[model samples]
Target: MKLKVCGLTKMDQIQELISLNTNFLGFIFYEKSPRFVLNHLSLEGISAINHQGKVGVFVNETIEKIAEISEKSNLNFIQLHGDEDENFIKDLRKNVKKEVKLIKVFRVGETFNFQFSIFNSLVDYFLFDTDSKAFGGTGKTFDWQILNEIEIPIPYFLSGGISLENIKNLQNFVKVNMRENKTLTKLNTPFALDINSKFEIEPGSKDLEKIKTFKSLLK
Candidate 1:
């Protein structure tokens, strides 16, 4: 499983996460988020990192604005954590020339469905997170069992309430789910695990020791 550390803000915290060789690092651009990074870190500073390219996270942001931030930040990926429609993402991709990966995040709830056939063709990947009216960084876990009922054609990342204490349990959950339905293997997909608020001491401030210890388990 690939590890993605989200809600990055400080340069020191960014460096620490890079040292862990995390697969992806996310920077929140949403102004409302307590973990917002656009005001704290400059585009050049984030691009200077030698490892783990940055991902710009946005919520209900305009396409022009997203494009501007992506260029200025030199972001390698965009994670849409808002209620962006499929047409919006299609246009955003057409406007940007960079080899940008698009990650569309869906907030899971009791009625949440994984009808990938509707939007899978538009974006590169899906990120499942817990649903909250305010949007991500809620640090709450939705039922992992819900994933078993959906059909995801593209690769995805599992987010929401993930922490050091529950990661092993999550892995075990996936393994057990796989055992129950052998057809799931036919999906032939690589699911990345996204870790956010749980690894932080506070909003935008990550706990390196906690991250390192959690990563050690993967090894």
Candidate 2:
């Protein structure tokens, strides 16, 4: 599986992940988040990074602001992680460059109903994260069994509480779920694993050794 390392703040660590070929590097735009990228790096600073998979994570942010940030930071992808409705997304898509990919996030809690029809046409990808009052980065995992019940059409990123302890079992989990949910054959398995807080030594500070070890195991 591809790996998306989220909540990045340090410049050196960001370069390290790029050198490691991490598929996606997430930077939080929400001012409320402890891992908010602006707290450590400026938009110009982020734009200077020579990586193509830079992702900007926003929560209930205005379309104008998202577009402005994307432009200034030169983001390759945008992740909507809040109660953004269809109209919000449609308008945002129109305002942003067509080459920039859109990822709509769905928080999975006790139960989840995957409405592929509602978002399939609107976004390039979907991200399923554990439900939390904090928007994301709760360091809690939802029931992976819930994915088997949904009708997933596009590729998705599985997030929340994914750590070294659980990384090895992820492949098995996907295989078993695929077998049990026969309809899943029509859809691809998770395109990537979105990891954040679990790999961090502190908020916004990732443990480089842990990430290296995890990547080695995946190989």
Candidate 3:
């Protein structure tokens, strides 16, 4: 499984995450977030970082802005974490660089309906996170059992409230899913695990040792 450490801010922490071979380093572009990348690091500064898995998180942002920021920040992926519909995704796809992968986020609440036909061709990946009014960084987990109810066509990143304490629950869930006859043979397990607030010492500031230990435990 891949590990994506999101809401990164400090350069040193970014370097530490990179050193740990973190698959994706996410930078939040949403201004409302306390861990907003722009508030801590300059676009040029982020652009200069030599990492292939740099991701920019946006919430209901304009296509123009997403395009510009993706280019300026040298983002490898654009994570759309809001109420962007099929048309919005199509438009954004046309505007951004072809090399840049798009990861459409679905905030899972009490009930979720997987209608992925419209998005199958538009995005490179799908992210399933806990639903929240704040868009993200709520650090609250949704019922993982909800995932067992659907057949996800595309490989997705499981996000929200992931930490050392609850890691075993995910492991057990995956084990059970593996044995399920209904699980699609064509669909693989979750592509990655996206973690944010739970590993942070504070908003945007990651606890290096905790993350290091989490990775070690996961392995």
TM-score of each: 0.92, 0.95, 0.95
Model 3, residue pairs in steric clash: none
**Top-scoring candidate (lDDT):** 2
For model 2, residues 1-219, the per-residue Cα lDDT tens digits are 899999999999999999999999999999999999999999999999999999999999999999999999999999999999888999999999999999999999899865656988899999999998778788888987778766788889999798988875777777886676567444547889899998999999999999999899877
Local distance difference test, candidate 1: 0.82
lDDT, candidates in the order shown: 0.82, 0.90, 0.89
* Candidate achieving higher lDDT, 2 or 3: 2
For candidate 3, the 10 contiguous residues with the lowest summed lDDT are: 180-189
Candidate 3, residues 1-219, lDDT tens digits: the string is 899999999999898789889999999999989999999999999999999999999999999999999999999999999889999998998998899999999888899875866898789899989888777767988888888777778778999899988999988877776777344543536789999989988898898888998999778
Poorly placed runs, candidate 3 (over 4 Å): 181-188
For candidate 2, the 10 contiguous residues with the lowest summed lDDT are: 180-189
Model 1 clash pairs are none
Model 2 residue 196 distance off true place after TM-score fit, in angstroms: 0.5
How well does candidate 2 score on lDDT at residue 73? Answer: 96
Q: What's the lDDT for candidate 3?
A: 0.89
Clashes of 2: 0
Candidate 1 Cα deviation (angstroms), residue 67: 0.6
